[model samples]
Target: MRIRVGKHGNSLGFVIPASVVRERGLEVGQEYELQLTSSGGLELLPVNQVIWKPDLSIDELLAGLPQEKLVYEDVPEYVPMGKELDW
Candidate 1:
């Protein structure tokens, strides 16, 4: 499909076809990130779907952290703020 870059308030924008938008679950005002590939191709991804570039290997990343981080924090003692319930 062909789309032309048009002017909008002195800025340029192109409209994604309705079929493409509906199929991709895209919505107005949603965020998108455009990636330029090494082979000179463009890739689009939702902000949440993008893999960050500062990729860290699991072994290297985890080696710095302590095992205690896996443990859940102890539950605190509960104090009544008001009159106790009759029940």
Candidate 2:
């Protein structure tokens, strides 16, 4: 689909289609990093930064630092599962 660059408050920008935004989970006023590919196509990426760790390696990183342990005692009883009943 082709979209024309239109003027908004003296600034020019293209209107992103609603289907494209919904499919990509994009929102209005959200930041995006735009870059030109080697083949001359534009790449639009979400500027929302997220930090994610795969596993306990992050815990190990924290363990290397000085930290205080919690003083709470463990609760002992396990809650048993109830028998299945038809609705």
Error of 1 at 56 (Å): 10
lDDT of 1 by residue, 1-87 (tens): 888889999888888899999889987788999899999977878999998876778888888777664322333564544553332
In candidate 2, where is summed lDDT lowest over 10 consecutive residues? 70-79
lDDT of 2 by residue, 1-87 (tens): 899988889888998899999999998899888877799988788876533336778777688654666322322454434552221
Cα shift from native, residue 64, model 2 (Å): 34
Candidate 2 pairs with clashing backbones: none
Maximum-lDDT candidate: 1
Off by over 4 Å in 1: 55-87
Each prediction's TM-score versus the true structure? 0.53, 0.48
Q: What's the true lDDT of residue 5 in model 1? A: 86
Score candidate 1 by lDDT: 0.78
